[model samples]
Target: MTKIIMRLQFSKTCAFSIVAFLFLFSVKAQDKPEIKIGGALRFNYNLSSWKDGQKKRGGDFGYDMFRVNAKGAYKGIQLNAEYRYYSEGFGGGMLKQGWLGYNFNERDQIQVGLTQVPFGIQQYNSHNWFFNLTYYVGLEDDHDMGIKYMHTSNRFEYQLAFFKNAEELGFGNNSEVSPNRYSYDVAGRNKEINQFNGKFVYKFGKKSASRLGVSLQYGGLYNLDTEEVGNHSAVAAHYELNKGKWNVKAQFITAAHNPENADSEDRAVVTMAAYGAPYQVAADFNMYSLGISRNIPVKLGPVSNLQFYNDFAYMEKKAAGFTDSYMNVTGVLVSAGNVYTYFDYAAGYNHSWLGGNFVDDFAKGNPNAVWEARFNINIGYYF
Candidate 1:
């Protein structure tokens, strides 16, 4: 009887301790950080004249992608990340971007990890669904593992960054270079390393809404075959103007890459890869792009607005006898509650990703290559 009484007392003590711990934890939870999650589900429909089989079968519609976004903040610390999943024919799955950041003040912050490279226009150089030629050449919307410092205000904004290298997929220094990625990178016999970037923008007009910017980038190309380091550099100037519901964007870039490949390898072209695929691109080129977009308020059942856009880009190769490349896309974006859709009519000539033979369209494309057109529609629901 005495032993049973002692056991009951012990149980009561344990229960009291647990209740006290829970109370303390609930009080402390109010001070903890908060995280938010968001994502999107997307699908695509395409009809290309170049695809004889698809054209004969009334074109094809299939899954496009699904992505997740995460963001969190507490005090001066911030976090951002996104991951995407695609079909096997694409790059399967990859991290679009992720970064940890600290804000020193309202206008100054620093980001570390895989971050977007500040080049040409701010976020995008094109308005259509398909980006400009700069994207295919690894200039627009490029990201690398780096550290970046940014300062922003109404009058001017500037950013400086240094990337040790592109994102790695395998372990160790001798691992094979994989092409399964979202952004184009040097993958064949070379890798990009020790890259530096600087971008400055001046704001003026219409309550400081318009912007003019210049961007500079320099990097080393490490050749695995020759064990030598080559050099690459690019300079770009961009301008953006906003008037009422209309927006205009223009940019010009000159880039050159000198890769130290083995004696047997071709030096005129460098192999670039993304989306689980590899292709050759010219080593030196000059490119320019222009885009215009206008937003119109409309009421079409669940749809609330419409944005019409036209984007065009041209690439002129520096190598003698190399054919030039160009792309043009005209599209409209429809916004309806949590759903958005894009209808695009895209055409290209001697350009990769449009109907050109994936081999050398961006290197020394067929001089007689003709224009090819494709119609595409993409729909996405976001939350």
Candidate 2:
């Protein structure tokens, strides 16, 4: 009788094992890996008051950039990468962003590798091709080599990150800092390192149409000449509101840099570089920006939408005898099928990339510098 009962128990155990194995196999078969590839080609036309030669020649039009993007996901693991090619004068070919991430669930995830810094604003702070003044100072749309953690929900979003440094030119312990990059960084005699960032956003209004946020950043500046570490910090408060066809954005930021430099080097300004050239930026400054845009639906041939926008930003230096900088952009974006174009009229005073010499305009700016204007058109096709 005991043997009979033991046999019955053994049969039931085998059936249970088979069922569990089949269930596990089915789950594995349902999970699939996915990948997508895409890119864009862009061209630009410009007429600048500061460029007398080009202006006399009826402006210049040429290729702007070509970029490739890739993304993939398997289970909860994700990958994203982008590479861009531009004229040698504009930094040549470089990696814009690359990251590997793992999703813990629907509301949380972590990313490792080169990723965008959570700063004053996300993605962009302006509507025009030329972003706000904060971008020139590395406070907007900056990317770094780091690990970031993100959490999202219905009412709040949070991001925390620690970056070892800006993307290095090569592997191993290399000290050479190059200006061949997409984003500006400390490049001359000093390099950015050991950075920490945190950002928080609160969402409100119907369907979360509005957001208010704050961000903080602190980082070390490693001076190769002095062989000492200095520090930099920035704080920002930002708000965005979207109601029907109208949108508005506003931000205020303050930043300071204290670098340990050789005795002969200047302390009032730090050298920042990108796009194949180095420029000097003020060591201490406060910046603010406000932008507004309105979207209108249209039907003209392939045209489907148009967005008109105006963005303005200003920077005030704290150093003695230093001048301030400001930029204003008025533009319209046209969207048609897979093609988009921007028509912008930009003006700047004592600002980099607008008129005056690129290097000193953001540093001890020329108090005598007059406002300069540029009419720009950028068109791109995406796939």
TM-score of each: 0.91, 0.91
In model 1, the runs with Cα more than 4 Å from the true position are 1-30
Using alpha carbons, what is the TM-score of model 1?
A: 0.91
Candidate 1 lDDT (Cα, 0 to 1)? 0.87
Worst 10 residues of 1 by lDDT: 21-30
lDDT of each: 0.87, 0.89
Candidate 1, residues 251-282: lDDT per residue as tens digits? 99999999998999988899998898989999
For model 1, what is the error of residue 61's alpha carbon versus the real structure, in angstroms, after optimal superposition? 0.6
User: In model 2, what is the error at residue 211, expressed in angstroms?
Assistant: 0.8
Please give the distance, in angstroms, between residue 215's alpha carbon in candidate 2 and its true position after superposition.
0.4
Clashing residue pairs in all predictions, respectively, total 0, 0
- Which regions of candidate 2 fall more than 4 Å away from where they truly are? 1-31, 171-174
